[model samples]
Target: MNRRLFTAAGLALFATASLAAPALADSLDQIKASKTIRIAVDLGSPPFGMNDASMQPTGSDVESAKLLAADLGYKLDLVQVTSPNRVPFLLTGKTDLVMASFSISEERKKVIDFSEPYGVIQIIIAAPKSVTIKDLNDIVGKRVATTRGSTNDKEVTTQAPQADMVRYDDDATLITALISGQVNILASSPQTMAAINARRPQDPLEVKVVVKTNPYAIGIRKGDDALRAVVDEWVKTNLRNGKLNAIYTKYNGVGLPAEMLK
Candidate 1:
């Protein structure tokens, strides 16, 4: 090729590459400059995130966010989000991080990055002490209630297909269905089960079997390596210093599970 033509082609390629490349934003620097970190939390999920008596956000996730902000020398701006909207908010730049009891899953990993697990929760099949349910097989042919579209619902449907499954719109309704005798067994998070037991201590429900194990982690927008690294380091430090356990126990009434310590 002629020198002139070669030079022209090189220029064109460079311009195209520059135009096609996404404009990368330094999320960590942005947060540092703004002096605030916006984190999304699910106010509806107790123990993880929920409203306190004063109707303000409070829970394990909330406390974790606070600690992260404090450690990073930034103010925390919590954005209330529902379970379904957590990722959307982060992807859309509405939040810097997500700590909504978000469990690390293969499906979610495709869209967003996750930090090391900060906590773990079990989805258990709970029933009145009088009723016996040792495993999935024990629940066969029995009425079971779970929140629609939850991991618990999916686990029950997949593992105990023989069980008569009833889906409710929310955790409160599912717990109600179980307590009201509408269902023989309830599949829910241990946190929700604890709340139920606290509210109705006389009924005395016990976890029959754990159907699913969920490890909670902070969700970061995909490709935000700086922010992800910072979060991962912060989580590791907290886990090592026992702050994570204190936060978990503060909300869930128990220490961090051994399986989640790593």
Candidate 2:
């Protein structure tokens, strides 16, 4: 090939490669400069995130995000999001972090980074006592409902592949479905079952099987090393000082696991 032609081709290839490469996220620097950090929290997910009687945002995850912002001396901008859109909001730069009961998983790790676990959530198959669920096989033909794109949904979908999966966009809707008998079984957290029972005491759901105990962490975008480190340190500090536990216990009605506090 002619030298001019070869040079032109190489330059074109380099430009394409550069354009395709993802820009590194500088959330930490941006947050510091702006003195504000936008965090995504799911208000539809009760106990973790929800609205109070006064229509104010109140929940474990909400308090956690607020505390983090307070500690960092930054203004808190709580971005409301649903389960399926949490990661998308973070990835798209709509939010600086996600404190939305986000569980750490191998699949999610491929797309985003996480801070050290601040709390844990149990994924469970809950049904009314009349429904027999002696083992995984018992779930084969049942209608199982869960919040779409959540860790609970992923675990149940993978474990009980034969079951008819009914996915809802958020926990509030999932809880309503269970209460209204739209589905006989659900893959969700114990907190969700509590929320269901709160509304319908006549027919309370019972835990049939515990799917998995998942550790939840704050979600940070990939390549945001500075933000991750800061968030991790904040988590460790809060976990040690009892602030995180207090916030979690206040809303969750249970203390954080002893091991997580350590």
Q: Which predicted model would earn the best TM-score? A: 1
What does candidate 2's lDDT look like per residue over 59-152, in tens digits?
9999999999999999999999987667667766789999998878776676678999999898888888888897778999778898998878
Task: Report the lDDT tens digits of candidate 1 across residue range 1-262.
Answer: 1011011232221222111123447789899889999999998888788888999889899999999999999999999998766765676678889999888876667567899999988888988899988889998888888899887888789988998888899988877766667776788877777777777777857888978778879998777898999999999989988899999988886678765565
TM-score of each prediction: 0.83, 0.69
Q: Give the root-mean-square deviation of each candidate in angstroms.
A: 9.4, 8.4
Model 2 stretches with alpha carbons more than 4 Å out: 1-25, 125-187, 199-209
Best by lDDT: 2
